[model samples]
Target: MEMESDFYEAALFHIDRERKLYSSMPSRHYHNGYEIFYLVSGDTCYFVDDKAYQVVGGVLMIINMNEIHKLVNSSGETFERITLEFKSEFIEGIFPDNSSIDIFSSFTKGLPMIKLSGQEQGAIEKRFDTMIHEYTQQPPGYESYLKMLLFELLLFIYRKMESNPRPALNEANLVHKKIFEIVDYLNRHYDEQHTIGQISKNFYISPSYFCKTFRENTGFTFTEYLNNVRIKEARNLLTHGTDKISTIAESVGFESLTHFGRIFKEITGMSPLKYRQNYKV
Candidate 1:
């Protein structure tokens, strides 16, 4: 699907894993939006931030904006999920003064996997059904109604979490701690040059070990993750300004316009200017 650039946006989907082997790996990437992933009927290993999660059916994984994540097909079983993504702009537009409360609390460090009871699942599913119907029908005032439905869905999950909090993730292991530290470093320094060897030296690990561990845990090579971060930021600039595309590329760490244009087109399927023209508010 092409990238969505609306200030207020929502989508619903049903996926069936019939064509591919469960061992087919998923790409690691991030977006400028919150993500709610509901496993409908599936089993997969989800790698988010610095930890791996074994996700099964009837569970929801909430990911905050710009958090790197991917789903790996570990078991060859039938896998399906419904994913919803909306930008913070969407949330803020709906709840101008109350968006903070609507956010999933400490989503980055907390256990984001919410296992729903049968009744709760049915309620959430019904909300999703209504959302799909309203979105597809696009009747009068559907945008406002869509926003209301999204808020209701989020409220339901928030109440479920408050009523039954999951235990915090155990990050006592030295390796996990180090990995998180590396992730933090990257998030802070994505505009700067980063290399596997340099990062390994900073983290006091051999380059080979760092490569293996990073891929195993985050499902991304250092360079791949860095490019994704840069591209995401570039998209933000494109949407918010009329800056010269070359300047935006340089600001986001791409060294040359040629290279930046190639990567931009590769990820977004549109030239930077085209994307801006399409999405500019």
Candidate 2:
């Protein structure tokens, strides 16, 4: 659960580490790249963009770039996971030059988690192990083999997506979509100060109406939502790098380091420095 540093490309990755127990050494945060975690051991509860998913062995969780998320294993138990990270552009390198991006695009977007059967998980695990071996050894022309293995992995994911599709549509789902859209926008633009009035004007609603609806939908008032947003960003920076705490405070829309530290502790139950110490990659 520490801050792990990795540079991922378009290729597949194979991980088979064993954890003795469920340790919440690090809390929630975000990454700069896309990820696919194929759980090979115990169950883990994960938060991806604030939506929680209970993933067990034989389950696969897909995460997009810059997405906020984290993991916690409920039981006092150990587990293993195969985590693969890559860029979306890495897709063009896997697929043929003329192949359409349609199939691949969907994989990165909708319904980001899936649970696989025992047999299905075993098959993918075997291939992933073989792919990892070849990638690490790098025999002559191994790139060709590596690329082929990655293509097979993609094909498997696409087929699984086809088998168990998400529900069609509902009014509740529409409101959920709207809420997530606004949240995503705020996450991307938290540096600029914006009031309920501004957001309501943009969303074509009255200020009071917008505040009430947003709070009802997201379970947090506008100011609370904004504070949490900044706190999440601040934690990411503190644990991920050596930037000055003050600089991170301002980067996350906090006007002062003291306020950032106070709120961070209120949410994370620890100060920024302590959080950083627990997550040195």
Candidate 3:
């Protein structure tokens, strides 16, 4: 079963409990809202940013806006999960005088995934169940009620994390470890020029092997991932700084303004100037 709701474009809730296998790999993607992913059953490998986490039943992944991530079946079995995504403004003034606690700090600064104890999982899953019921029923004032439920869920996780911080369950295979290191390198050095042959030589892996392994682990070809990283940073610069479009293009690793404009439009659906005009704060 699956259920989804879009609350006036401010938030979304989705629940899936099907027993199925992935016929094709899902693409790596990012978005402009925070995401909460709760694994209800089965196991999978979740790639967040550069690290691949071994996500199992009762695991929760808190992803900040614009973080690159994807999920792959690790056990070749069925899985179920619930996803909630919301913009920061959705809960901006929902809590009165709650100035000290930033409920979303964990998404931005803390661990990416948390393994909950049996009891904690039951309690958190109960909240998710209630939200599902409320959304399905849509009784009077249910929208407001759903917002309250969302707040309660976030608060529960916040408190639990404050009390018992757990480390992420990272993938341990040697190949995955090396790929993650390369991913981290790419993320940090997206502004620099790179090529598959060059990166393969630097990383001490054969070019063919590097290409195959990178796509298998990250769901993106080497060039695709590099372009994504550069474009993500370009978006940040466009939205936050008053830099010339050509300068921004060169700064984010594009050799020419024409190439940068084309790729930026391909990824973001708009030219750099238009994006900056629309999204600049």
Candidate 4:
């Protein structure tokens, strides 16, 4: 099924649990809402943004909105799983509102791709079973019950896998909040001009200081990080069979063909022609 925005607000959700029932083909695309999938049975290759996961029973995946990724099973096998989708605002509403907030952090940003341990998996699944019951049965007041159940399940996962029992508001951490803001903005608008001076200027900081701290925090210089984003977009378009390497380069915001070609070759260690040629095989 083609997943869409707000598949989570009262959520036009779906679950599948049968041989060849819920498996789908690979198409590298990004969504506009959060999604969680539990591989309840069988094993298959699950592709996320720029990586692959050997997903089997009890593994959970959180596919956040706007994260360029895809699902694939090159082995021509079937897998069983249930997928949950929700809106960002809905999840954000779960945060506490405090006026004294200072920093700029978001649970939505820098989310490390996650996997559940064997014990943790079983524990979360037990709660998921309850979620399935509430959702399927849809008894009286089931709406609130369903939301409440989902909330608890999420909290349970976070508690088990995350160091924090509950994530505080972004304002809780000043430096991280600022960095996250910059990263979020960059991700959303990397196709535009995003010099360190421009970003630092908007944030009311000196360019030199911003560059130094950003490198320290994210472990990459500003240019390197921007190219990383561009390259990821390029890979997505290429994997999805978009034609014209020149078009992909422009779409990803490189201003010049020569510069784009050089950067692509530098990072990927081959020309775009070579890159796309391999995918044709």
Q: Taking the candidates one at a time, how many backbone clashes does each contain?
A: 0, 0, 0, 2
lDDT of 2: 0.63
Candidate 3 positional error at 129, Å: 1.0
- Model 4: per-residue lDDT, tens digit, 1-281? 75532222224454434446334535666666667777654444455555554443445667666665555543344555677766635434444663243112222544423444434544565566677777788878776666666666666555544564332211112234455567556666768877887899898778888877665444356787677667656755776865688888888899887898898777666677776776443
Who wins the lDDT comparison? 3
| Local accuracy by lDDT, each model | 0.65, 0.63, 0.72, 0.59
Give RMSD to native, each candidate. Answer: 17.8, 17.1, 18.1, 17.2
- Candidate 3: worst-modelled 10 consecutive residues by lDDT: 2-11
lDDT of 3 by residue, 1-281 (tens): 53322222324554333445662326667777888888765456777776777555567889888787778864555566777777777666888888889888778764777766544655676688788788778899887888888888888878877876653333333336557667767766788999998999898999998887776655456886777667767876988998899999999899999999998887666788988997687
Estimate candidate 4's RMSD in Å: 17.2
* Candidate 2 residue lDDT tens string, 140-193: 977677667776777777777776566221112224334445655675677778
User: What range of 10 consecutive residues in model 4 has the weakest lDDT sum?
Assistant: 165-174
TM-score for each candidate, following the candidate numbering: 0.50, 0.50, 0.55, 0.46
Sequence-dependent TM-score of model 2: 0.50
lDDT at 71, model 2: 76
Q: Which pairs of residues have clashing backbones in candidate 3?
A: none
Instruction: Give the clashing pairs for model 1.
Output: none
